[model samples]
Every structure is written in C-alpha cells, then in structure tokens.
Target: MSLEIRKIVRFEEETLIEGYKAAETPLRMFAVAAVVKNPWAGKYVEDLRPIVREYGPQLGELLTAKISELAGGAENIEAFGKAAVVGLDGEVEHASALIHTLHFGNHYREAVQAKSFLSFTNTRGPANAPISIPMMDKNDGGRRSHYLTLQFNINDAPCADEIVVVLGGASGGRPHHRIGDRYQELKELGHDIENPAAV
Candidate 1:
C-alpha cells in the first residue's frame, strides 16, 4: 500500500516580547504537519508493520525537509520534537505507530545532528484538534530555556479516517527565561550529574 498524503500544513510562532520584556533575540518555533489517510482506521490490525515500516521513514523525511527549510537548515534548529493526531475513528495506537518508531525520529535527530531523543505526543482527536509538539534542547533535555511547545491546528484535518503527523523545531528558546536547568536542581539535591535519574 502507498502512503497517501492529503495535505501539508506549516506554521511558525515568533516572540519578540514575552511577558512585557523584549527578547534580546526573537524566539521562534515551527511545526509542519501532513494529513494522511489511515489504512486501518476502522479495522483491527494486529500488525501495523507494513505501513509503519514503509511510512515511518517517508513521513520523517517529508516533514523534516519542511522543518529544515523553515529553520533555514537543520543546523539552525536548536530544539526539536514531534507529535501525531489520529482521527476520531482511528486508534491512538495508530498515531503512536507512525511517530514512536526509530525510523521516524532518527531522521530528525540525524538531520539536526542532535544528541537528545525527539520528544513526542500521540492522541486521537477530530478535525481542528490541538496539535502540541513539546520540545527540548537538541542536545540537552534538561535545559530549561529550550524547553518549549509548538502548537497549531488545521481547520479540516484527519477526517474520520486520517492521521496528522507533525515535526517541530525552535530557532531559540523562551525569551527572558529565568528558571535554571534541571541539572542545576539535581546537583543541589545531591543527585549524580552523570546519571541524572539516579535517586
């Protein structure tokens, strides 16, 4: 089966003044979404490998290109993430299958030459549902300034049998950010800096 994409939506957010304090450099975030037909929308498909395998890399590449172009190139992106929204008739698993794969995320990670894993969210919703792509520093997940969310929506997407795959990027983090990074708090708590999760 072929990957059938119905449309692509791209949006960008730029913040010059955040909380009444002007950002030294404007903060910008971007998201690219592709509306595609869900083959197993109304059926119970135990193995989603066929489409997952074929479309994972395809969607990754397709969305990555758009995101890269928006950021002026992959290297220009300092933070990144992804998300998927399945139509009302589709399973949340279907949304997860497309985005939570190595094939899909590796493309963006490799393109940006990032060390951190791509953050993500998957859900089932109707047309115009909120599409939120939570992001973090491309190389440092604990970086508080780079922690961000790129959100937008399409008026008529993921019609009952469709899925919207998304990729997001940020040229810079929150303007006027004051909170310290997670690592700092961990250090104060006497947690090992080497293995942050070590309690």
Candidate 2:
C-alpha cells in the first residue's frame, strides 16, 4: 500500500471573521486531507495492521507541523477550526489510521479538544467527492472496525494554524499511492473543503 499526503491553503475573509467572533480572539480556519493505501482491501493481507497503528502517531505529528507552517507559525495558530481526512477507493482501513492518529490526547490535545474530531467510513468512488462527517465522541470506543473507505472532519480547534495533514501508505515492502492530485482538482472546482475565513 502507498500513502500520499496533500495540503491545501485557502484564504477566506469570512472564516477569519467567524473565528474571531466565536472565539473572541485572532484565529484562522484551514482544511486538511490525507490519502493512504487500504491494506485490507483487494488482497487478503495479514499483520499489516500493526504497520498502520505504529505509523499513525508519526503521521499525525507530521500533519500538525505542516498545518503550523501553513498558518504562518505556531504562535500565530489560534485554532484548528475545521478539518477533514478522506480515504479514496481501495483504502477504507486508512480511516482507522486517521482516527487512531487524532484521537484527542494522541496529538493536539492541548490545542484541539477530544470531542472536536468527527469520523466517517466506507467512502468509495471519486477522490474529490464532497464529504460530510457528523461530530463524534472521543471516549466512545464502541465503533466497529471494518474494511472500507473512511473520512474525518474536525472543528473548533485552537491549533488550526499548526495542524499538519498526513497521508501514509504501507512502509518499505509496499507500493505507494498519490491521492493529492484528485484533492487539488476538487479544490480548484469549488469544493467546500477548506474554511479560510473561520480564523
């Protein structure tokens, strides 16, 4: 499996106003996505789960750093505001990787609350499809784990400026994939993936 990470920066005047109005402080809104290979689909793979599990945290850190750079700097980062992590066709397992990566205290705990992250599963077809994921719980660990595409959205975070987006694929002995191209296409076509004004 292969993983490709992509970052999109959108400047929205309204988002900035909204963030300031809501938080009563200077803020910025940004959207991020990660595309990775699905190890559970196509082939009857074994033991690859650990690979994703181990790399999940590392990927999340990378994403957070990237977001900080996009936001200008960590000191300038006021909030995460909104975010999304979507896995394209053939990679539903990638969703778990993302969930495990951003699970409250896992990464930006002090910056983003546990309840601010949302998760969705089983998304297949075009990589640029519009996505809607309802808010989810940080402690409700009862969700079933399955093989299918997945998506995630996060909102009302204080570390939006420093948030990094990561897409990871199988390490070493696996093929790599690139889904950033499709995300870029969707962005150019007017998809509401990024909230530039939220901060």
In the range 1-199, model 1's lDDT, one tens digit per residue, is: 9999999999998998889888899998999999999988999999998889999999999999999998899999999999999999899999999999998889999999999988999999999999999999999988989999988889998799999999999998899889988888998998998987787
lDDT of 2 by residue, 1-199 (tens): 3443333433321222332344233223333444443434444445555656655665566555555555455444322322333333334443444454443224643333333333333333344444332222232222211111213333321121122233211001101212333335546776644552232
Ten residues in a row with the worst lDDT in model 1?
190-199
TM per model? 0.97, 0.43
For model 2, what is the C-alpha lDDT against the true structure? 0.36
- Clash counts per candidate, in order, are 0, 24
Off by over 4 Å in 1: 197-199
Pairs that collide in candidate 1 are: none
Which candidate has the top score in TM-score? Answer: 1
Return the number of clashes found in candidate 1. Answer: 0
